[model samples]
Target: MSDSNTSDFTNPSSFILQGIPGLEEAHVWISIPFCTMYVIALLGNFTILFIVKREPSLHEPMYYFLCMLASTDLILSTSILPKTLSIFWFNYREIDFSACLTQMFFIHCFIAIESGIFTAMALDRYVAICYPLRHSTILTDPVVAKIGLAVVLRSGVLALPTPFLARRWPYCRTNIISHTHCEHIAVVKLACADTRLSSYYGLSVVFLVTGVDVFFITMSYAQILRAVFSLPTKEARIKTFGTCGSHLGAILAFYIPYLFSFLTHRFGHNVPLRFHILLGSVYLLVPPTLNPVIYGVRTRQIRDRLLRLLTQKGT
Candidate 1:
């Protein structure tokens, strides 16, 4: 190993994050839009959470799941964007090794939890549409609490290994991460040691959480489609589809960019670097920014409450 890499293992102090390599000159400009997105994400999700909390009528399973989603989005965005903006705006790029691992852990853990929540939402929708009469009994408050707890614990436990494994790897190279955040692969690639097992583990985690969530969500939607088409009237079908619109939008927003980014990372070696970086940024930013908008526009309850709250504040 080179002397610098050897020293990295012996006395690693900090890792420098490269935000967007060629756009260092434009970081000030970049921060404007990124900061805007972060603000929108925060306000939008917290509004959703507030609406859920204040509205007693929205104490159903579907809205409860929505609350979980909003909370997850808020935490996820908060975890990354502040540090990201610090890097972009102030060139605050160095992160302590242990702190980097902790950030990476929360990032992956929340993502996994969000994916699990998506699956739970799917199941909730399936029961609501397929077995309407039993929906209340099936997804009672206690049950929702249990599901929420399980989702949190599952992701927390599963993602624990990521930072631990990365921490153990001897980073025998320049401690420069190629992205804004300390992503598992981004940090692990800095290590000179063989990362095959860790890399595979990362892939496995992705497939395990996202893959399973997508599979179940698809199944739920398929069953929903079948049930919708079986409705007695076209109006009934339209109404049913309308109710699912917000969720479908949220799912597409979350998964499409995510899957695209994942593909580009593994297979898009020839693709432009800007595309890879921007896609990852979009994956992180878009869902949080758009989820509340989709929910607000499509769900009458949230929209009405939000408008009332704004009106009250204005008055």
Candidate 2:
């Protein structure tokens, strides 16, 4: 090969994304459903934001936390799906190195924020269920704002390192990323350098964020269950449990697929490439798509408010 050919192979200026490698012929067909999901997620989350902003009745702690959740979901899905659709619909697969890192940073950061927000929501439920009278005083507007800020900062600071570390590592060859989006570990693996530290750091960040959030959320729900069972009447128990149903569903929608993706990617190396990519995409896409539906159907207040808003807009 000539020096130019060697140079082109060795140090390409941009990376090509594999994007479901063997499904090359199906990209357009696959993009149709994904585009639908992205649309639903955007509309759902934006409606939540709109309802929260317009309804004074929803200006309390629970809805405030929900607003945080909706906002995070919006950012998360927006960060990922647009670029993915461009790849599928436009076949524009070239992503610059800096842009790739930037995407990786936002994706991981919002994921951390998503986990943290869910944990916060669990804590909110615990407070409201286990200690109703103190709930207002405990999660007052100022306190809720502070908690929201803390969750953002915590996720941001922790996730900031992963992309930076990856960017600084040398990549002397093979600029093709093996997935649809620039996932941190996937991109890191492409680097031609010792990535043990980066790998461990990524694992640690995941465990630290998701692990702690999951632990706290589980404990909160356990306490909530205990408190519900202790209710003096079956009616009270039913009401309390009903209130928690939406949150529980949202949690399952997110964590179950998320854990499956994480485990399969990190440990299930024997898994098919398509399965890994599909699972990861599902993990990212499903929660944002379903969370609004869960909340809208289950939370009577949001459902009623949304109906009213739509009715008003219709006439």
> How many clashing pairs per prediction, in order?
0, 0
Mark the regions of model 2 whose C-alpha exceeds 4 Å error after superposition: 1-12
Residue-wise C-alpha lDDT for candidate 2, range 1-315, written one tens digit per residue? 221212334344567777887987898999998999999999999999999999998999889888888888898888889888888888888887778888889989999999999999999999999999999999988998888999999999999999889877777656777789998877877677898989999999989999999999999999999999999999989998899999999999999999989988889978999888877777888998999999999999999998998899899
Error of 2 at 203 (Å): 0.5
Displacement of residue 5 (Cα, Å) in model 2 is: 11
lDDT of 2 at 274: 86
For 214-259, candidate 1 gives per-residue lDDT tens digits of 9999999999999999999999999987888888899999999899
Each model's C-alpha lDDT?
A: 0.87, 0.87
Q: Model 2, residue 138: displacement in angstroms? A: 0.8
